[model samples]
Target: MERNTTRRWARLGAVLGTGALLVGVLAGCSGAAPGADSGSTDTDAALKEDVTLTWWTWSDTTQEQADAISKAYPNVTFDVVKLENPDAVVTKLQNAIKAGKGAPDIVPVEYQTLPQLTLGDALADLAPYGLDEYEDAFTASTWNSVNVQDQLVAMPSDSGPMVMIYNKALYEKAGITEAPTTWDEFAVASAAIHAADPEAYIANSGDAGFFTSMIWASGGQPFKTDGENITIDLQDEGTKKFSDFWGARLEAGELSGLSTWSDEWTKALTQDKLGTLLMGSWMISGMDDYGPAGRFQVAPMPTWDGEPASAENGGSGLAVTSQSENKAAAAGILKYLADGEGRALLNQNGFPSTIADLENPEWLDHPYESYGGQPANQIGAASSASVIPGWQYLPYQGYANNVFSDSVGKALGSGGDLNEALVEWQDTLVQFGNEQGFTVNK
Candidate 1:
């Protein structure tokens, strides 16, 4: 089945802003039509073919998982290429697509960057491969993130449903017995924790992605897109609620101003100077690297009104390139990784995205020695299920993130007014969107 090369190239040009000029040039140079696979609807026959696939990813695909994928599809060989980071993968993928060559057959794309890639029609649509049948397998928010403009462009790999990881020792020292259920309680605990140890704080602030996740958990629709028409409202009720609550605490020095993942931040974690971490479920795997495992405990994200609410922080999906000559083989590999035995192997090292894993009694109740033998997955599962629906990221979210440091980041670092910084961020996005030929509304 050969996909429409002309249409793919034209969409690529639209993303590159070279219009039909680049389209005509690439169409002529693309050689054989892309996705010229046998187009067999039979999955068994596709898996039997001897095909080699290049998988570009920033995360590790363990040898154990590789061996399992190999045994499942003996004829399929994978060339796993590890990149420096997610941004590197995105940059390389865009350049390869624009050049009409050198793109890998498979890539793990972050959920935030999925729309940016799909805008150029660079990934193969998986709906034809029976991927739509698994719609019920994932939560609505996780499923929606991988589907862009009604196209199932990627397979749900792993998700980052939000959770609160707190230092039990610090909470005990602050005279707090349990995790705060409401934002107001969290604020009070923050003050107590900081007062208990002048060098310690409840959490760190000032990362763009973290800020967006907080707004998302608070039920903010700050960014929404419908094709080329987008609505930007950083001043929504959710955004205001988050800004006002966190801003006051930040100004009072109840939260650390340290940037996340920085040397100082890691040091704070190692020394137990950081009391709590409001992060994604994926943070569970790395907790032991910073401090003793039994010292930390997982809890549901605190809510505005003492109700269950959550949002995704980081997650990615496996996507097949539209330019691949082995689309069927690539999709077969995706199916195995996303929904087959390979999924269980991957879940051993990360959080699960599928409902089967999230709801499994055994998986949810599995205890971790790091959290003092607590079943941390229970909290993660509840958070994933409670994620607010209708949350969306901009198609050009990469650009939005790059500009956040100058606007909102500065305010957060200085303990300035987050609400005003959000307005500035929204205005910048509006101007950039309109310049990109989008119908942007504020």
Candidate 2:
């Protein structure tokens, strides 16, 4: 909303060095250097010497991606460690950096975790790796999510742009001609769908996090600050209004109060029990597993009856840890992953790429027959362009999630009184921000 480019740059510069590094010291005994592998893709053979680049990633990569990387870059050996627990990754990373041993070269970081890693100084600044040159190739929002303080600390691999996915059959059954474009319309349309089918409603009505994501889409920031001071905005009128609307719907028995991001919700989605879902682009893969192929379609997220509106859901970025011995090599690896070809490779491996890889007509445009014969890949890519960027991802974003989750649980668990729980959550957030030395004003 702020169009003052020069002022925004100035603000970025001011906060770039605001946080102090927690700890950063590369560990472990002497390891193999870069280009040590020689023979096959095996570590021993590829490096010739013993070159092991430790990589910590949250989830498993596709076999196709692994095979391609192995074949293309046989000289570098990667000790890829898959993590089932994400918090453990951060904990282990911090401990390794502090102890000066067994530190990983690359780590997959969620957008929300940027502050945690960067504040600790465990991650490397990626500017030297030609980040500037490839910056324009990525979606503006995706690229800016990882580029904080004018420092490109990480390369964005994938992002979750909020999307409105609906069951065309359900909507038609409900006699709803068009998808809702505003919150009021969304509510009215949802009520009509429920009236018609008794089971139709928007996505899960029980999840407050889902509501928070929607609130943000309406141009409401979770927290607002004047650089030196922060304030909790959860109890603001905007949030309360959303809570009331969503809560009322649940209480009216017009919606299923299932948890968003849960298997139950997925079942509801696949079975077409819900009318529409405010989901992310990455959610497409699960559709094939849950719903019959080609059953749903995507529309823009319903607005807040206000200004330009959209909210990002989930995404991961690639960050080079300071512990990496081969920074250049690591950067090179990222360069391959973030650019057009690299993005395409990521898409091939199940990760959404911001770069338009469907430019070639020969490439499969319509990969799925489901969804009433729609070109999903192209539609999903076009949605990426509408996402708003340059928002602040505070260091204590995890705390914010905690606050939201607890508030929601309390509201649902205690007779649906969101206001009381929100007041408490707001206070907790203020305390957290202050304790972290972030500005928190009353």
Q: Write the per-residue lDDT of candidate 2 for residues 265-302, one digit (tens) a residue.
A: 77787777877777667765556665666568767777
Q: After superposition, how far is residue 313 of candidate 1 from its true place, in Å?
A: 1.3
Number of colliding residue pairs in each model: 1, 18
- Model 2, residue 248: distance off in Å is 4.1
- Candidate 2 lDDT: 0.66
Quote each prediction's TM-score.
0.91, 0.79
Looking at model 1, report the run of 10 residues with the lowest lDDT sum. Answer: 28-37
Q: Model 2, which residues run further than 4 Å from truth?
A: 1-50, 62-64, 85-88, 98-100, 197-200, 206-209, 224-229, 235-241, 306-308, 350-353, 358-367, 413-415
